[model samples]
Target: MIPQSALAIVALFASLVLLVMGNSSLGTIAALRLEIEGYEPGAIGIVLALTSLGFVLGSLFGIRIVQRVGHIRAFAVFAGIAAVAALSHPLHVSIPGWMLFRLVLGFCIAGLMLVTESWINSHATPQSRGSLLATYMVLFFLAASSGQFIVALGDPGMYGLFVIAAIFIILSLVPISLTRSTPPQMKRGKRLAFSVLWARSELGLGGAAVSGVVLGAFGIVGPVYGYEMGLTVEEIAVFMGISILAAMVVQWPMGYLSDYLPRRLVIVCVTGAAVGMALFTAAFGQRSSMHLYGGVALFYALAACIYPLSLALTHDMLAKHQIVPASSLLLLANGLGAVAGPAIGGAAITLLGPSGLFLFLAAALGLLLLLALHSFASERAPLVREQSHCVGIAPVSTAVIIDLDPRQESG
Candidate 1:
């Protein structure tokens, strides 16, 4: 019999392909919308903002849908919707049509992501949970990074972007369709326990909240920021690609470091570094396109690991049973933060200029860092003894790793 871990690895890999396709396709469109459709920056911001909003809504509903229909069916349904929506981008040709499509696309992606993450979380045992989650995170980061690189393959004007996206999204569907492993049975769907979860471990709650905001900013405004800075579509894509790459490369180290160090300390340092980088980049202002790419890459790399580092820390603080509630709380925090991050970032760019993007992000990170430090200081409990043998985490299950609460349930 094939091992569950191997199946999970396959599922996560598949999800990565879809992630690249979905995110990259959107990235390319964002970069090209101004030139191709002649939309104003504000309109562009609205489209991106709506998409983030759709994702937040999707996460809430996806859990219920998956509960009823099962993971595999839900995956196919959403993936198919995403594929069709992506293809339809070329058909609309109008800005309003495109906006509607983007919102649909956003909603569809949320379903796909939630279903995938839930599947993974359901199957993983505490013994191997860390490794499993870490591996899945690594693949996710890599795919997200590579999606941006797809822009370099061809012009956004041609059908190439849509086709590329379709290919990735379609490919993402395969492993789950073929796998024989049964997805874990859902008990009740995850619900927000915000106050309790936050009170239990401020670091975990704060981490989820900050990550959502950071992701929203990066997803919604990252491309737009590059466009405003005079980067060509190709360069903008490459710049985003580089940022994701930095995140991908840094994840494993961050994960292992979390295992060995105090998680709150690690989070503080990462958040502080992110704040510093954003401030420096905003102040420095890229002289040339190349400079922007390099700076953005560095900034992304520094900031991207915050989520995983926070995840590791959350796990460290809680008892085994507490993980589920903690994970659910984190997801809620992330959704709320994600919604706020982009709109605020976009408004900053509109009001203050492109550098305002970084300025806004820096402010957000500054708050996160302060919270992390404060959380650490207030907790006076003795550190748990380091276990000689850490838990062995399996690969992510396609059913639940992408979009649901990171853990399906608490106790």
Candidate 2:
């Protein structure tokens, strides 16, 4: 039987799953549509990069809207805007118009996540927080992965998929609007400056930024790469979906390993593995779908571990009270990297073709591996007691989600 605490947040979780599914499908569909419309790789990259820019902006400021209007009302407002953004894409097919719409989608999606995560965190007790967070992460990844298959439902060039996406976005407001839970009281927390955070853990900050670059680039360009390589929309859906699912597959083992080993060492190993997979994909991904899919899956499986490992590494060096602010700063770094990723990725694709995507990933992961090795050599390793247990966290999250981490100390 579900605990009362778990049952209490069922409405929020339902809304979260719906929101992610709709937003994820919209992103994949947008990229595929641009490729089909014959947009240049650079142009497509810029358009997609704008979405990340909006996300960064929202992460910085969207919380104020929530604090002002309250959670449920804020959720409804964000959802309404997101639904409009989804429909806007098909209605206005110009690059500028689509860019505007994608930006709005990103901002609103970030806002929605902020409200949902903060609400859930507020209601969580120390006893229930761990299980609730574990459930939340599972649902988040599953919805995102499954949402990719929605692209297979209709032509990317048509209105059907966009309309369906809009419907999903609008429908997400239902549970939240009906929920009886009162809004959580918002509190202002002191933020750790990036310069200070970097001083404490350069490897952590660097790893997070690079992880965002990798994830952001792949999210925007992976579908286009598949489309360019002669994949059917359905095949592209399967390829991307499996790659995302593969990210979740490796998290637990990676997190467990980091708990025992030096996190920098684990990071170096994972980064090294990701680099190898990236090279494999670049070399053979175009020739065989099996190689392409398998290589991409392994690449993400290893690459996605970097953020969580970096977070754990940072936690090792900070006081327990500092965890929340440090996480926000790290996420800010990740957001900045995400803003740059698509442009870098698009430039590579323009020069090297579809396989260039993996090459860029290889280069980024290679840089991160070198940094991890350097940090491992320079810094004294933390004792086991000083280290925090690793938790699998998504880089796209708002800082409020950090409160749900079991590593956080009770007030």
Candidate 3:
């Protein structure tokens, strides 16, 4: 048998590749529709929102695949669907067709991500889970960042990007599919116990939704916004790359701090700071390249911290049995936010110009921060308390704006 450590290394590697590629593809698509294909901004927002809807729908129920078909097989099935959808870019289908395909791709990507996470969770002991989680997070950040950069390499009209996406999907299959390690048989169960998860912990669910909304807005609509403002593809890619890198660099301190502090307090502070930053940019930032760099950096730092803090907050109250459900609920919430984010943010920009993008983001964060305060007020337990558990970094690796759904993984 292959050593479990070696299997972990392989699985993590594959998962990272998929995540980076999967995450990056949305930006490319949005940019292409706006810059290359000359799509209407309103239509693009709806299309992207539709994709988020697909993700939300898939995540809510896709767990059935693991129980019925096994993780490896289910992963392959979704990977194949995503690969096909991604590779079909050459057709440059009509707006309606693109939306339909995006919807399908959304589900496929969600399944791929969920199963990969579950597999990693299965292999890791609590002793090593933190490190494992950290490693996964780092790789996810790198992959997501690198994927955005890939858009800079060629014109969207070329099939190279699609081919690149296909290669990533295939590459993602290598590590886990080839592993000698076999996870424990999945417990056959309902696809998703939505009501159960919601009743258990709404906080984690909300965190996930916020995470989805924040990132989804930036991921799907940021490139499109940049394009409308006269940024070339390369510059647009750089904007995303730099912003994501900022998010990655900030994660260590943010993640570390999350373990010790009340997650709710940290969330309110970071998200509130993000809202302030967005408002500042709307009122004072320049539209020039130099300004874009600074704006993206600021946005990236504050926006990136929200989901992690939310995850930490929700994780605090969860019982052991609740972790998986809670995580799923978080993801689901994020997915819904992701779905709504681009539509609202994109529409804001479409109606009021690019400054509206920041305005939309600022308002959303501000609202969440306020709601968080209300939640704290109603709580029976102290908002800040001694942490009962140590989330020591596992030897591993590894949000949104309104995440109100009581589902999906927060991190």
Number of clashes in every candidate structure?
Answer: 23, 0, 46
Off by over 4 Å in 1: 1-12, 34-36, 93-96, 118-131, 189-192, 288-291, 381-399, 402-411
Better of 2 and 3 by lDDT: 2
The TM-scores of all predictions, comma-separated, are 0.84, 0.97, 0.85
| Candidate 2 lDDT over residue span 290-383, tens digit each | 8999999999888888999999999998988789899988888888888788889887898889889889999998999999999989998898
| Ranking of all candidate structures by their lDDT, best first | 2, 1, 3
What is the total number of backbone clashes in candidate 3?
A: 46
Residue 9, candidate 2: Cα error in Å is: 0.9
How does each model score on lDDT? 0.68, 0.88, 0.67
RMSD in Å for all candidates: 4.1, 1.4, 4.9
Q: Between 1 and 2, whose lDDT is larger?
A: 2
List model 1 lDDT by residue over 1-411, tens digit each.
978767775765677567655666555565465445665555666666666666667766766777889988988888888788788877767767777777777777878777666666666675656566666666666667677777777777777777777878878888767766677775553454667666667776787677778767877678788777777878777777777777667666765666676667777888888888788778776766555666677777767677656655666666656565566556656767776777788778888888988998898888888888888788853264431112212111222453333332333
Candidate 1 TM-score over all chains jointly: 0.84
- Model 1 scores a C-alpha lDDT of 0.68
Sort all candidates by TM-score, best to worst: 2, 3, 1
lDDT of 3 by residue, 1-411 (tens): 877766676765676577556547545644565447766666677787777787776665677776788878888898888888877656765777778878887777767766776666666654655566666666766677778877776777777777776777777887778776675454432234767655544555665677677777877888877787778878878787888778877777776676677666666777778888888777765556767678767886778777656655665666545554555456566667888888887888888887888888888777787777776667643345543332312111111111111222332
